[model samples]
Target chain A: MFRKYRKKSPWILHYNAGSCNGCDIEILAALAPKYDLERFGVINTGNPKQSDIFLVTGPVTFRSRERLVELYTQMPEPKVVIALGSCTCTGGVFRDMYNVEDGIDRYIPVDVYVPGCAASPELLIDGVVKALEILEEKTKAIEKPFRLFKEASSENGIINRRHSALKVGEKDEED
Target chain B: MSKKTIHIPLGSQHISLLEPVRFKFECENEKIVGVDSDVGFVHRGIERACTTKFKFDAIGYVVARVCGLCAITHSLSYTVAIEKLLGGEISKKAKYLRILLLELDRIHSHMLCLSHTCENAGFEAMFMRIMGDRELVMEIQELLTGNRIQFDYISIGGVNRDLDVQTAKKIIENLALVKAKVFSYIDEFTNNWSLSLKFKGIGALTLEDAYRFNAIGPLARACGLPIDVRNEIEYLPFDEVGFKMQTHNDGDINARNMVRLNEILNSLEMCENILRGLPEGEIFTKLKGKPKGEALMRFEAPRGELMYYVKGDGSAMLNRVRIKTPTFACIPAFSHIFMGEEYADAPAILASFDPCLSCTAK
Candidate 1:
């Protein structure tokens, strides 16, 4: 139902996972007039369940790891996660810092990685736009109907649960 | 009969909060009675990293990562402290370039705080307006330093880039635009009835409370306490570049917003003066020495006073790098201000304090 509109309107859920505020501000600037990510019908939502794109900044910290995962899980399926900035990608300058994990991908799957010390607003706008394409693919994958190509068995076309009876095109020796 | 107080918690993550900071407020009716904040969420163990992983020369950039908003200040203070230990004199042109970047940083940082404060108050248009105008400063920053957010502009003996004629023209043009927008904001903040009502008497901090709690930056300045690191530090020629202390006595959100607005104007004027008096000298000076002693450097970050303490043990690896960020210092005062105010106003009040948790956590 949302296929056509989904690509046009991708709601964003932004979370700061222990970043230096560089990427976070850039994300806001992207939403601002000059770069204007909002022109693509993108709305920054606080609710994870309603969001289709999760824009996460900073290298995941010990304390924020749980929040990062929780936010990711809370976001509905067929979602795109964009890691903004080098720190969020591979910990950047903060790679060796004790409390920081290498990047957010250590805790969750990231589809788009935009790297910079603090990624520029222009780059952030580009990242979000790229996320829209990923979001479209995930949405298509989720909504695509599954089809059965062939029969499973000769007798009843029913697959057996037991491992010994689970032969595809041949009966088990005991059978 | 005894009255029961209700507890309302706002973030380690919340809609109004941009970063992870959790505060539990115990409220008696609509008034907040107690506050407990947890600001360690953004801590990256940067101090430990400084002493062990990075060399003295490279720590300037590492420390800059502490907070993006005040990155320039962090690097400048760290570089200044290192220079003090090295005991070398950089060119006057280099100092001017450093000041130029510092003032530009302050302008953007204060504008961010003001815009954030507007956002938290549910003034969407005002927030967008301020944010849209902020790009003017950001454009200049990018032109001068080649990056918007993390401009690793300031280096040990000098700056990373020099200002060229084209960039200088861009800086002057954009700063004028920012200055114009700032005036309109000032008029809106001072005259708008709804904004005045929401901000005027809400979350008020008296001069006595400000002093007792040791508030710094715009927070203290708004309360009429003249505690500005810019005035105290002689390392940079702040006085030569027309640095003025902006203060307001009311100590409410409105007062703090006014202070920020006025400071932005002052910073714009300084940037103009710096560009106008473009001196001829080298931007970087090569100083040959290993840092051996301890040095404490303090500068006025946009949020407040940023202090960097560096103890180098003559080796490439230093002993300790402690950053006393303004947000960390103002936590006590932040909690104090939350008391006796409506729980609804918490976000606006919090934004007005301009807390930088990354800086604090680092």
Candidate 2:
């Protein structure tokens, strides 16, 4: 019954961590009339307390990082985070830009990943559906809240967040 | 004696969460008492680069890249400007092709702005539906120009490639599909009470304010001003083509979206008319010599009026090329629109202007 409820209503909060509006435009395109996502009960909410899924875009900027963390913390439990577009998932073409924070997962833990320059409508809708499943799982584990990346170390502290999948001292290509 | 003064270093570096606009948002208790904008980021010195780096005809392709979304418009305006300077006349058939491509571009760019605005407003379903429909426009562009985004189709004197009969038929068929979806969504979106409440009068800018700001595109048109460049400029046969100029008096975000949506419909019809009445002739005019004079050409890009000022020396290379994008003209308008609105509505309202950072910064 709870699983069905999660599927029936997955409230989302979209945050533009900072991007070229291309991906951001694609994200919005997924919501308009032709895609008709409202039939799935995937509504967008401005309030974090009401949101079950956080659809974060762009390659989180340095200045927006703290604000993002604050927003993430403000959300209620049983939440699933989705990093939308190539920028949030891997920084895409802007990986080398000085101001970009690399990727959103560098700051917040992400459960579902949608990849595209600005992801297509089909892909974005699919990602939202997948996030609802994750939301269902988080609801079951209410007592423990939710953990995204198991490898996320507490030692780094909030100011210096390590990429969840990144290993210590590894010279990996920055996503 | 009473004295008060505070200096907040806004940006030639930071402040705007979107494009590289540095502004000092001087506030007294969260009310913006004063604002100052410091532009010129990613200036790449494109104007200077155009004069020194590119040949007269080659610059058409370079200008297209100035704004990824408005690429076709920039290239179209540039080609026309150069043709005027060269004193060359494009074939009637080429004019029809130009009209077809421009309308297709307008549809794509407007849909993008609508969807992005909905996204910023936290409406995902609306965004998706608009975007899905947007692909049809992009597909049409790709069919015409071979590339989805920056279509290097427009050339000096005329188009580089002709719109094949088969492709024209496909474009017409695709537009039919878009029409169905667009109408359905418009009905759904306009009827949604929540969407209406969120957008209706939230970002209202008076006609006077818009005039003072010198807003362009849907923003200016939404305020009841008939400022379409197509209405003013002397293009080949746009006069014979029948279509209504889209406008609204609400002067708010919703009005802007409505204007864009209507423009898409009008654009589709314009494309169909051009295809049906396509004239048969050469795609480009043969030019053997160097350019000799300066030319100013303007066009109605999806965002608004786009002006191209090109100066050619007695050589193949251009001496100077200056572009005044619609968004550049709307900077003062954005400031005016931003006044007295909550911080939350700032970005969405700003986006409704269809501000392309690439075009403005260039």
Clashes of each: 1, 19
lDDT of 1 by residue, B68-154 (tens): 999999999999999999999999999999989888899988988888898899998888888899888898888888888888888
The global C-alpha lDDT for each of the candidates, from Candidate 1 onward, is: 0.88, 0.73
> What's the distance in Å from true for residue B355, model 1?
0.8
Best by DockQ: 1
Candidate 2: C-alpha lDDT: 0.73
Task: Indicate the docking level reached by candidate 1.
Answer: medium
**Shift in Å, residue B20, candidate 2:** 3.9
Query: Model 2's DockQ?
Result: 0.09
True contacts kept of each: 0.87, 0.10
Cα misplacement distance, residue A31 of candidate 1 (Å): 0.9
For residues A74-141, write the lDDT of model 1, one tens digit per residue.
88788999998999999988897889899998899999999888788778888888988888777776
